[model samples]
Target: MQTIWAPWRITYILGEKEQGCFLCQKARQVEHDEENFVLCRKTHAFVLMNVYPYNNGHLMIAPYAHVSSLTELHHDQLEDMFRLAQLCESVLTLVMQPEGFNIGINLGKVAGAGVEDHLHLHIVPRWNGDTNYMTTIADTRIIPQQLEETCELLRSGFLLEQKER
Candidate 1:
């Protein structure tokens, strides 16, 4: 038999889950912006890098209101969330040069939401053959760039857009 030693997963597998809502906690603490991996912040929403990403430059945009269901959000909230998603798409394109993208929201726990209470839209950049043997056989993904470096690039791109606007 063959084995893949993904020791880093043990932290997620056995680590004590954080209490309360991380999105809410991170949103309120501007002091820990870097530690929280927040790439950009607007009035209604913020973009955060996925701690466990499907690919390089993966991000999630969430409303600061701490709402779960999409219907709970006001029209302005929805508008801002999508605007941020579009901005994220551009930033990812410029920074990662991904051929495509997969963007969506997983509503509840049964719907595959890791953090079910706080609604978030995932922005996963896709490339040709981004999935391969590691995914099918070993259940692992290969991300080419460091999270912080990708965050910096995307953050810079995001800020540049704001400045130009």
Candidate 2:
């Protein structure tokens, strides 16, 4: 069997997991936005890159409130989250030029929510032939760009986008 060298994953595998909601932690740590991979912050929600992404430009829009489901969010929070989703799509389109996008929220653990307690929307950019043998056969998804670089690009993109508004 051919081995894939993904040394970065070792940090996540061996690192001590932090307690409490990571999204909430990130939300509170505004000064650490770059380290947290936060691209944009709305009034009630924020957009950040997925550290374990399904695709290179994968992003998550999450409310500041620690709510398990959408029903728990105030209308303003829910609206802000969706607006952040639009911002994610716009910035990803400008920077990555993806042909398509997959945007949704996984409401529960059984429905594929990794962080089941925090309500978040995922925006995964897609291109033709993005899925290949590596994913279908080896069950490994390849992300082409480094997270820091992507974060910087998207952060700039979001800034430019906000400036135009």
Q: Rate the local accuracy (lDDT) of all candidates.
A: 0.88, 0.91
* 1-165 per-residue lDDT for model 2 (tens digits): 778888778988999997899999999999999998988888999999999999998999889999999889999998998888877888999999999999999989899999998988999999999999999988898888788899889988998989987
Clashes of 1: 0
Worst 10 residues of 2 by lDDT: 1-10
- The parts of candidate 1 lying over 4 Å away from their true place are 1-16
Q: How high is each candidate's TM-score?
A: 0.90, 0.96
Find the candidate with the highest lDDT and give its number: 2
Instruction: Please report how far candidate 2 places residue 141 from its true position, in Å.
Output: 0.9
Instruction: Give the Å error, residue 56, model 2.
Output: 0.3
lDDT of 1 at 142: 78
